[model samples]
Target: MTSLDLALIQDAYAKLRPVVHQTPLFSNRLLSQLTDCDLYLKAENLQITGSFKIRGALNKVSAVAQTNASGVVTGSSGNHGQAVAWAARFMHLTAQIVVPTTAPAAKVEAALSYGAQVEYCGTTSHERLERAQQIAKDTGMTFVPPYDDPLVMAGQGTIGLEILEQRPDVQTVLIPIGGGGLISGIATAIKSLRPDIRVIGVEPLGAPKAYQSRQAHARITLPSTDTIADGLKSLALGTQTYPIIERLVDDLVTVDDDEIRYAMGLLLTRQKLLTEPSGAATTAYALRRPAQIRGQKVVALISGGNIDVPTLCHQLNP
Candidate 1:
């Protein structure tokens, strides 16, 4: 199995410096008061391609461009698909993205806008991945695994390096979990650099793969997932991501859709930032468990802001 380490993440940071944005780590006074902690938001929602997935996508695609493969194919709910499409375009390669039929129209359009051919598959990560792999096989294109590949994870880890540099006194970090890519990468970087700092992961209560997997002491694959955080509805943890998370993550927690919606509303109303449900998950946990993390310096990573207008209105009002 592939592994992630600090050195690999450092290399990714060096490689990405010319391309990726070092997004802000800014604090909101109201949020800090509410959570009773010095809370900062790692604003990857403002990153290029509108999410941190671009970091991994660009890093992976740049490496693949050195190969003889004609192009690249991958599956995503939305954010990663957009990143892959954008990266492929930047690298001057043809790209194909397989997304679930239920993926948001805005996200699909965003991917298409990057000039990648988009195909709709069944409404599940597994189905989309299978179809993407088939396409790659038939076309002799490289298959970009969203969260499982070491290059991708290392690329994502660059965020951790930025976080530590931005806030050396950070006591805890709350990251939203999907297939464990984001959390696994960040946890590896943080723990490798500052072993004393806590790295916590938050998941949607409806899709608690990482939380459940930790309890079961083995990877757990859900037959189905239902979550308002569509970007976080990964049915299983990545094989490569799970082991790193298991070893380095301090704790795994969960918040329901309602909490996520509340967090999104708060982010918009109070922080003046629009965050998707997946991005608001960690903030939701922090709000819900203020007593647990109070009196500490905490950073909540806002993973993305690619929400459609209707969903955004509903989340803000509901």
Candidate 2:
């Protein structure tokens, strides 16, 4: 698969350091022991606004600095919306975020806090995207898709730049799957530099597009979706992300909702990292498939930490 050029990603890292946090790359001895590999955690959960969504969101918003974005429009139920809204505010631009009614109020409030005008719609994320597209077209606003753009992918690729430097011996990387932004970005950059470093993306079986898409040899927009991994509830991989995954991603593993909850519990008890279900996907994958990771130095990209409190309380029953 064609991967991103490392120099380009490095340049993006240079551009982003001021706004983006260089979240820690800490070794998780317990996780490593579970996976039978040398495992490190990419604490992207500690990033600004608690998610890596900012990297791509900022890159896209900043790219439009010349246009001055009359208004920016995008569809998201969570992190992406907040990221876009935050980036828009940073650029002194107006942002119009479309979300489904099912999205958490905390996320919507966070977006509004950053000065984005919020619109809510139907039950499903797909319905929200449809509304967002119409809003962009009707208003002459730029529609920023969460994972469909090359520029955004390149921006997200900054994670790969960090990975290579922090752990050169990393033989494997497990990243959470959403619209496929995080994995696509990291795979594009890391595989280019260290072709031997296998990139295994983890998706919740509750939201299984990445795994299904890989098996089909094409992007499969699932007819319907359900999962506690709110960040990964997208129905399909973006066109931009699909091609990259087919080329660069080494494998895609899926874990069910219960497994995800178990992983989250493990993270809290074992690593002292408070992660949302989606963020724990890679770790769950590693635990389940330890044989695949045995003897290798691995990293699980803990993508974000923004779990809704009530949701966590219910899921964990603590």
Candidate 3:
């Protein structure tokens, strides 16, 4: 289990300050009453790129600018692609983003909107990584992995900083896990600063790579994931992230698509928050498995809000 120093996370916050939003941390009394505890929402769904990925994307691309790299190549389900594309545009560099065929149309279009050259590949994390790595090698561009680098993880840790700053009494944090970068960074930052805090991870049951890996005490790759939470469908956690999760993270849980959808509806109607399935996953875990989080000051991290119109309509209507 590797640990990042507070200094590193603080540096990430400082670097990201000018570019990123110090997103609000809201406490919903309704959520607190339902869970029998004080509940806070880290509304990262309202982030600049509509997700927290921009923190890492900007951090990595800014570091890339110091070198003589030709451009940047990376892979994402959607939000990270847009974040990287926006970061590249911010630095006046070319960005080629390889996305899976399963990636949402809105996300691919969002990347294109940010001036990235979008390439459709196989619907798997491995496939996108291979393509992005090859592009970086052949084009002399820097390969910014979606969730497997120190700089990226450090950048993502900035959210943990904001959380503590906003609510120093935070007892537990429920963060959605995809490739584990977000959880890895959050756990690292929180544990380093306040080891008493509990860091729990939420993943869709359709894609329980992180949960399975933690149980097996080693990294495990899934054959496929059939979750609607596209942002939480990575086949496996990163090598860099797995150990940190195993070490620093308190627990990992999974929620089904129905649970996610129900939570999404609650977020929309009850909480008055717009969130995609992936963003709603943390709330789903707390709502579905309430016993674990009862009586604790919990923060549910809404990771993104880039829901497509059809899915949004379905979730809203259903």
Backbone atom clashes (below 3 Å) for every candidate: 0, 1, 0
Best by lDDT: 1
lDDT of 3 by residue, 214-247 (tens): 8899999999889889999999999888988999
TM-score for each predicted model, relative to the true structure: 0.98, 0.95, 0.97
Which pairs, if any, clash in model 3? Answer: none
How well does candidate 2 match the true structure in TM-score terms? 0.95
- lDDT by residue (1-318, candidate 2, tens digit) is 423456666777888988798889988777777778788899888888778889988888887766865878899977889999999889878899998888877778889999999988886667888898999899988888787776677778998888888888888999999888788889989887889998998898878898898889878998888888888988899877888888999888889888888889888888888888888888888887566788888888898888777877787874
The order of the candidates by TM-score, greatest first, is: 1, 3, 2
What local distance difference test score does each model get? 0.92, 0.84, 0.90
Off by over 4 Å in 3: 1-4, 316-318
Q: Can you tell me which runs of candidate 1 are displaced by over 4 Å?
A: none
Deviation of model 2 at 268, angstroms: 1.9
On the 0 to 100 scale, the lDDT of residue 43 in model 2 is 89
Residue ranges of candidate 2 with Cα displaced over 4 Å: 1-7
Clashes by residue pair, model 1: none
Candidate 1 TM-score, C-alpha based: 0.98
lDDT of 1 by residue, 1-318 (tens): 546788888988999989989999989989988888999999999999889999999989999999966899999999999999999999999999999989988888999999999999999999999999999889899999999998899999999999999999999999999998888889989998899999999999999999899999999999889999998999999988889889999899999999998899899888877788999998999886556589999999999999899978877777
